[model samples]
Target chain A: MSGAFEIYRRWLRDRRRSTIVWSVSIAAVSVVTAAFFSSLGQSLGENAESGSTTSSMLGLSDGIDPQTPTGFLWAANYSNQLPWLMMALAIALGTAAIAGDEADGTLEYVLSKPVTRSAIAMARAAGMVTILFISAIVNLVAVAITAPLFDLYDSVTITGADGSTSTASGLTFGQLVVGGLAAFAVALGSGAIAYLLGAASGRKGWAMGGASGFAVAGYVLYTLSNVTGDLEFLTWISPWRWFIDDAMMVNGLTWDILWPFALTVVAVVAGWQLFLRRDLQN
Target chain B: MTVIEAQGLTKKWGDFAAVDDLDLAVGEGECYAFLGRNGAGKSTTARMFLDFLRPTSGSVKVLGGSGADPEVRSRIGYLPGDLNLPPTMTGIEAVHYFGSIGHEPDTAKVQALMDRLGLTADRPFHQLSTGSRRKVGLVLAFMNDPDLLILDEPTSGLDPVLQDTFRDMVIEHKQRGATVWLTSHVMSDVDRVADRVGLIDQGKLAQQLSMDELRTKSTGNITLTFPDAPDVSSFDGVEGVSNVQVADRQLSIHVDGPVTAVLARAAELGAVDIQTEKNDLEDIFLDTYSHEAGR
Candidate 1:
């Protein structure tokens, strides 16, 4: 379509400033936290205990030793702070892609052009992906370049609670990449829900609120279930359960990473189709 | 050829009708003015023609094709009642972006329009004043010189001078065989641009008139005064006159069709003072609706 490329290109151009700000700001947190990880010294092991709210905040999974380089990197940055903020960025992009324009009447004006609604929907989705991918790349680069400087790439030996010792491996590039990809996946999945809501109802506030609520509710459910061990069965539905289960930085490339990618495909198709059948709000 | 057509077109939200059973056709090279008060369904009907809102139980065609067809849309320029673009978009970006997406708009023409409307490219759309935004809309609508133009309240925020300028542009477009379907309550603007007028009330079209017919029906209020109180019954059954109300020394009379006959009648009744009130949208609506009731 004649207008589709221009719309997509224009959307990306419009998103450039925000994407840079969000990516840099989030990566700054990751790097700053990673830089301070060495300062914590032996306190890392005490912070890694599971089954508490504090443990949930650190995204501590069972059997992981935060005193180790891989565990500290996972617990300190990639597990909670990185994925959570990245999810926010993705949600923003997804909601802005369709519902934001529609609410403000830009989508209506664009429809007056010689482009199909499908073209606009597809272009917006593509634009969202482009900006999100850029954000993920910047975050990965920031973490990768700063990892060794913070001793995240060095192997460490931790004394067990039983007084036995074992050597822990350093964080590899492959594991780092997997960690970044997993975070990106979780963020994209949250964003897809936002996209679906925005497209289904051309209301920006609703989309943003619903998607944010979904993310917060999922995390809360997972955290509460982890502590109580009562609603453990319910934790299956939350993305946080799978994300924290594998903690890809600690355990590289698990099948649970497949959840978000699948949901993203469904969201793109459903959002686009739903948007086509709706009225453009003035 | 008919450039725009709507057959039994209707739009309803639940049970509340925004537009009801409207059948309309605008020929090529003609200017059709759709006149209505706020919430009278002018915008809703226009939206249906552009496929922004689907009709409940009718069909609409633009240039002999569905508005959903890109090819049909490519030959049209539309300006919404409330023009909104991306807030961060400057007028230059809007012109380039909107200009390119459809037909290859004439660059020279676009420049001329911007100059004529005094629209600048420095400010983003949200930062611009309402009038400035309307200017951007006018430029976009005219830049393409499309086969059909559907403008909703196109001159609401424009100053009188710019409104006149807009009328000139619409006339020019009509001269070039572009069909224009515009909705405006500004009679002066509509009087200059519309070849025909359709009056709508409460979502149903009450009347449609050609410019010639409307000119003939241009009714007004003529206030006449005599030294003493005039008898209201004295002016009864007067030709081209109605609604004669005598208050103290004044006789407020409504003159329809021709004022000449009423003037002659007033002179015989010893009127000392006379005043004429020109017709506005409300008067037009009353006149048209009354005629409909009579029919």
Candidate 2:
């Protein structure tokens, strides 16, 4: 319907300035973070021993040296800062997609028109996705063009503690894109939870806080499970399990990356249905 | 044809019912004012008519169709009691955005409504005062020339002049065959626009009466003053007059309807002056609420 299209246009236009600022900020952080790689590489190489606590925190697998170009890139930005920032952005957008507007009374006024709630749901959901995509693209392109400046594409030769030297591959452009998608997937799935909570409750604080708590629980589950391995059973609920376990930036694309995407679909459908069934909040 | 109809419509949250078992029908080309005190389920009923809040039981139909129907809603204009748009959005932007959605508003009509209301359309919603915000809302609700207008406290924040303007706009809409359903505490608005007033007290319709019926019911008291102490007995047993009392040179009698017979008696007594107390809507509104609350 043309009405639905216009609603979507207005939704995005309302958030366009924030989206642009978020994208540019992420790019700036990415470039600035990458610029310090060489300066920190040697110390991290000497101190960040394989299988250490630092590796687990950086989301690196056992024996992946933090000083390697691919390892440092994954450990420093992709696995932590970038995904966390993007996920925060996604969660905010998703929560605002319904509950935020409802609380502010804009959604109720919009619903007063000839546009169906389903149309508003679909249009706002699409707007959230567009913001995520644009932010991810900007983040990926920022790292891609500037990775060379930071020597991230140069291979690293490491002398193991056993006195044997081995060559680890440099970070590739394809891996950078894969890592970006992986981060996007995690953010999308988390955002879906935020959207679901917001849509079902129509309370901005409830949705935003509940979604944040869920993300935190997932993060703790994934990180603690990796270190202990005894809590592996609970890690299934945490999206961080797939994201950090694969560390797509280091391991290349894996089947595990699809898990967040799948979770997103399920959460979004559930949210939309609940939204359709309930009363619009005042 | 009834432009809006509700049959035993009710809304309950858990055990508390906001609106209960209400049956009402507002005909086309009429202004129906839904009046109540705060938290009396006025806004809740309005929301149900717009389908923003679903009825817990029974049915509410607008324009002979479901309120949930987009086509039905297209012909409806709505303004909430507490109007809030995005803080960053200016009134002009709000009009453009909401207009772009469904039923693209006529630009000339929009300008006319804005000009008439004296709304500062370029100011963001947050920058405007309460009355200014209400002016923007009035323009939007009237801009579409909708078949039905559901306004909740439409003149709450409006100044006296703008309140009059809003009443005029509502009258114009009614003259054009557009039905109006509004809730207001402002008696002037009720007096100017409402053809019929439905007093909803604690989610129930306590009374429904037309403006003429209300005026007829307003016959509170007629005080006859004379140069000398008037004969209270003379006014007794007069038609449509009761509670006759004499104090000094005045005879005060309560008249429920016409005072022709009572006045004739007073004329015969050569009453020098006369005073009539016409009860306004506030008394009736308070009576309805207190009556229902005491019950």
Candidate 3:
């Protein structure tokens, strides 16, 4: 096998157990969230159609109609909740890919090979990205399967705020899949950031702690920047804000996506370069 | 034809010099043993050879390529002094992983080596005993059939039978015209297999000698029991003999060279029976190190 593929294979074999666990957990969360939103949307739709006063269906301030598919509710809620779940999973898996090997002394054996050190880092990062992609797909599938149950239970047509109405049968599965995949790209970017931190630190605890703290810190800074508008420069430094703004799951792609994607590339490349240049402890 | 050449190799950690001004050459098809005490820079030298540890000064060239170059690294097999195998991997997996790194070994070659070395593929590395783990390491080192082999304390945890088997493996590699450089404090191990030995003391090469030359330099001992009280004092001044002790008709003399002259002298003194023995490698090694330290 080529060196790149060999490294990728090794990474996959090493992380097979963790990857399975992450996929299952993410899929479970997606299922549970999909179920909860479907029931909530149905109850609110019944209240709206019966001419009784109730909160707007799907938790929106706008009115609900009986014609639209329940898939819209699933997509809206998933787009809001899934990013955090995906971020946590990506960080956990990416942290282990590089730092775990260093802690276990396998780094020496791997680096002793004929392949360059940079290739090792790049291949491992690629493996983590692959894992993130798999988890995202599982999450999307869960949402797609569970969202239609809400439409059956509510007996209501889902309508957009502009008074346009569509039945559950009218929903485009392809659009939902594309939208889900775009959000997954954000998870991939987060995985790269986590991998960079892991390689730089060479300690799993430190890498995980630092990545989590960075994510939380970035979120807080982005919120503050949004509230104060004048500190807009701070949003550029926050990966979470950049990912959310770029994927535009709530609305659509924004201009801010460009900076975060660029930063993600820089972080990943820097991490790989550090791993190549530093002497392996083992 | 030098297979490994290290010139003015110096490695220092902060103010401490781990390896200092070292120059070594190992010829093709030769088994060269590096002998040193614990913390005497033997492992440091080995690491520098593989470019695992960067030298503070100087260079190491393997097969005419720089030590750090992938081309050179692929042609050399190294068994690190501290054998740290990944606990999660099986013995076979570990070998396969290294084999992938150093030009993948053919399945037939790996199978043959595992069988010869008595390594089981089913056992996880953490489950293996120390001797078994060493066998795992041995398989990795020899499986690739590289042009140069650098082994550190290669026989530390082996049983006598396995050690003998390992000696045969080294010989087999030599027969294939590969150069082997191994480091060990066990003198007899070098005596059994090494063609030439380099003795290092305190981060410096104190002496380099062939096995035959080493045997010649160290004095041998002879114990003689005279049939009668034949005044063995007459044999004391003879050349090639010293440290003569005579008590109750038993005479012991330290012989430095061939005993032909000493035996003839003993015959003249009416010796009835005499036995001669050579000094062991351990004693010779200790004496050599002590003598060098004293100098």
Candidate 4:
């Protein structure tokens, strides 16, 4: 167990520079996006009322107002930029867990030590997850520091289904935390897929390409299903459905967020089994 | 006691056999040199001993245990043919990182090795030259003072000085009762240290012999300066004389063993000047391969 931890710590140290760069870059983008909320808040209702096709397609439908801090944060950051940034980080880190090191021939040396393949696998996965969590936490802390200044805490006016108007309270601290966890879960799922591909194939490019393709396909499938009722069943396969359709940040929480987390577990097991059984190719 | 043992070891990749059924053994404190050309399964065999590659069939035992066992691997020091280190890590960091994998390495020993190899401890791996990278590998492999050393082409990128240092280090370890198995294209390194040499060609063990046996296998040539161009066939049937040729006033006879019969024939030819040149290991190596290929 200590040997595995040692491997974990060494891998984290190896990825130190990359972790810092990705974390800071993602945090900076989140902070800058939060800065635009005040001005955008003023025209939020008009933009939705204008019946902009773009807003509807982006899940910014009438029910999701860009005026509130939660809605704006979700639309501007979490919905697109935040999840995409996290996915990019996850894929890069996940592919590197095995495929990258195998290609570089470093994994063989590491494995030559008095450590089991299972220990090394668990250690690498742990390191990758830690980095992903750090990036998510950076984005969350950046948003927390910048949210109040944009009047993101003020009560939000949410019109009901029967033309009744009501003000929903300001974005609560709990909601923001839950929202961050949801985003992290989504990234974790995507990264796990990449990790699985890398461990199974021992090819970095395959992992990167396969995971990225899965993300794009999930998005296209989910959005097209919304645009066409015929493909609605495909939404279950898209992680986007659990993230956006449930309106995790705005409407409080639901079981949808757990899907990605569950997928992450399954992927890890599958990857571990594949890695242990196969040869470490050069 | 045998420290290394393999029985019917075979490794195949689809239709291609990287290593065929082979049985080998290396006794404690013996220096066994594995010699083969490129793509000759030397590195593949080494990898199997470390469990980096699983065997298709058969078994290899190291230190009386399976190579796949961590306890067994902990006692072995391995240097791969292709040494790769993370570009971001300095030599100092690598020493610490790889050293922590098993029992702690002696700091003084590591520093001494670095000094002897002329490696820059603070330089990142990518900044180091090819020879310097090999130096780092040597330091890492020798750090733990392991019981068995499996080095593949250990002196490939080394300078002549470093190569000599490596040879001395191996000899010192052997003196201390460590078993050494290594592969190298530099026959001199083998000629100077190997107790036994195994020649592998096209995934099969072609020949296995001791250093003295290898020396004896070399063909010695006798050059005789005659008064005039003599008939080469005049000495053809002489014992141990072959490929006899006469050029100008000189007669050349190739002898595989004792030169007594050739010397007698030369005396009968009334040769004024006679010279005998012995073949080295390099000649024997080439001869073995060519002879195998011819079959």
What does candidate 4's lDDT look like per residue over B159-185, in tens digits?
Answer: 898899999999999999999999999
Candidate 2, B102-132: lDDT as tens digits: 7678888888899999887998889999999
| Predictions in order: lDDT | 0.86, 0.87, 0.72, 0.85
As for TM-score, the candidate ahead, 1 or 4, is 4
Q: Worst 10-residue stretch by lDDT in candidate 2 chain A?
A: A45-54
Q: Which parts of model 2 have CA positions greater than 4 angstroms off?
A: A45-47, A50-52, B291-295
By summed lDDT, the worst window of 10 consecutive residues in model 4 chain A runs over A53-62
Model 2, range A1-282, lDDT digits (tens) per residue?
888888888888889899999999988888888888888866665655545456666886765566788777778888888889998999999899999999888899888888898999888888899999999999889888998998889887877779899997788888888888998999998888899999998999988998889888889877777777877898888888888877877777888887877887887888899998899887
Docking class of 2: high
lDDT of 4 by residue, A170-250 (tens): 767777788788888899999999999999999999999999999989888887777666588877888887787777777
Estimate how well candidate 1 is docked, as a DockQ score: 0.66
Candidate 3 accuracy as lDDT: 0.72
The prediction achieving the highest lDDT against the true structure is: 2
lDDT by residue for model 3 over A58-153, one digit each (tens)? Answer: 222232232334333433343345666777877876787788777776666566557666777778877877888887787667766765664433
Query: Candidate 4's error at A98, in angstroms?
Result: 0.7
For candidate 3, what is the DockQ? Answer: 0.32
Ranked by TM-score, the better of candidates 1 and 3 is: 1
Give TM-scores for every candidate, taking all chains together and pairing residue i with residue i: 0.91, 0.96, 0.80, 0.94
Each predicted model: what fraction of the native A–B Cα contacts (within 8 Å) does it retain? Answer: 0.83, 0.83, 0.38, 0.59
Candidate 1 lDDT tens digits, A29-108: 87898887677735866755534777776777777778877777788778888888989988998899999988878889
| B49 Cα displacement, candidate 3 (Å) | 2.6
